[model samples]
Target: MRRKDSHDGPARGQGGGTGGSGVTAVTGGGETGGVTAATLPVFLFPSELLFFSEQRRCHRRVLTLYNPYSFTLDYKMLCTSPSLYRVLEAEGSVRAKSCVDLVVRHLNVSPANCGRRDRFRLEVRGGGQRGGREVWAELRGGEEGGGEGEEEEERKRRKPGGHQQRGLQLPLVPTAVRPSVSQWLLCVLLALLCAAVLMLPLHTDSGSMVPRCLHVSTNQKLACAYTLGLLTMVFLR
Candidate 1:
């Protein structure tokens, strides 16, 4: 009801500056708002995505997002070539100070696409902020091309630092073939049969009263031994 307040606009402006723009500010009045806007920087483990085109028909890799902030963070993944890749849970929220794994699958895995390069963008938003941060990572479709020397250099370049956060390494190809239970049982049976054949009497003494039909010839024993040896070798292999 009194004179117009000339300081009203300036006071509102100052409040906006401290509350909206000063994301890192720690003022008593705007501490919560500042923290919400200034979210802890999210990190991506491995920093790069690699797919083996020549190894399998489909390639899948995991990309991890670590949210170190005390508040929850919303993240969305964007790819340069969406048709060739599929990201599971491309848009989701990670809890405060927690990590989330994104399963990225390469749909078009072929020798022709080897060495192809792509880019991925992670947009993280928190604290009800309008605009958020963007993190970029590189994606390679296939194994590095070059000789052993070049491959060594590439390996050195991708080595993680001591302080860097790393995730578990996943195998690109299936594991080695292992013998099944049935195969083991078969091998054991063959071993027992071989032993029994070797224990048979190759010749019957003239003084013995054993039936002549029961006598095993030397040639028969040799043949059995040879056959069992071959079978053992095959199963062992």
Candidate 2:
């Protein structure tokens, strides 16, 4: 007796576009979809910078400078902190339409200084070029989980606006990680499986290769060794 509704599910166009795609949107409504999820900024570039005197002593790196102008160009290398890392042969001249390699070296650092972080800058100036090209570098003595892009951006923003700035750095101490419940459960299961295999009926012909500790009448040492070995193997896994 009643007329059938034209719509199949929830009605559309009831709510305006400002709030969300529709009231039907289960989650991530409106501009939330456009927003980027925040993530850690890192010094993502890979470079050789480590302190291992016994293995590979002083760290060495090279930077190539090119002069495209018709006249000769003068290049100079500068460091933010000279103590952290040094510029080996900093001063040089590059001929017109030519390039030269700038070599830099790491100083003798004690193992006590391991796991420390430092940074430096090398600015190259030339009369022929309109502006100096700057190269930013960092020294990492040990494995540290971190990134530098976000902090640098924040520093730049605060510098222009004259605000009190806070330094960003990686934690010197590594965060401790605890084993999860699933991992412990998996380890228990593996130990039980190993025990079951070792405790099977010794009389079976299939297990002849297994140590005959239980059957031996005179010696118990072999049996003790077998048991100890089984436990050691389980723990190792």
Candidate 3:
């Protein structure tokens, strides 16, 4: 059987660039003047091939094939995705070479092979927002996608919250300290101290009943106690 190999240069910045490892300068002109789309760098797989051979196992027909570039065991089956088989049938054996060739060129290297039955792991990487910072994503092989692809799809499905812009990160919890019972306790303790100081000065001078210090009036003593208590609370807080 034959294989029709193909790859779509993923949508620009889709999955954050997983096609090629080089920077591509996108230039354009507008009313303002000529402009560049900045340096867009990405990693990609070029030409590749998958070959399936028919054999008999336990008196039953079986097709055995493996893509060295595949990232999952589920797609390791020789005839996994039925749609791809149709493409192979359409292109025939000879044309499949072009498909494989494209992936190789995109990846910036000649492809490698470790026997026809060996599984493959293909990945593309590119620099992200900052210069020379690279991000990698494994390429999905066969007609079906793999684990990484499913995760990517899930990300696309999620919508950003109100504070988060389309491409921006969402803020977590806010910075303000939460209100709690300790603050209330501090206020209550300060009030009790003020009441005690206000009543202390009213009692007659006596060794056991009167305060031993300066005989300030009830209001003054209460005000002083309130001030000191407030200061202590502020410092502790």
Candidate 3 per-residue C-alpha lDDT over 58-106 given as tens digits, one digit per residue, 9 for 90 to 100: 1111121222332211111111222222111111111211222211111
Writing each residue's lDDT as its tens digit, candidate 1 over 1-237 gives 011122221111112222221112111221211122334454766566667654452377777776666666666665556667766656666666567666777777766666677666665777764233332233344444532345566566678764445677987998667789998788778777766766666575565466666667778778778878877876777
Off by over 4 Å in 2: 1-58, 115-117, 127-130, 141-237
Best by lDDT: 1
Q: What C-alpha lDDT does candidate 1 achieve relative to the native structure? A: 0.56
Error of 1 at 68 (Å): 1.3
**Lowest summed lDDT over 10 consecutive residues: which window, candidate 3?**
88-97
Report the alpha-carbon TM-score of model 3 versus the true structure: 0.19
Ten residues in sequence with the least summed lDDT for candidate 1:
9-18
Indicate the worst ten consecutive residues by lDDT in candidate 2: 21-30
User: TM-score for all predictions?
Assistant: 0.40, 0.33, 0.19
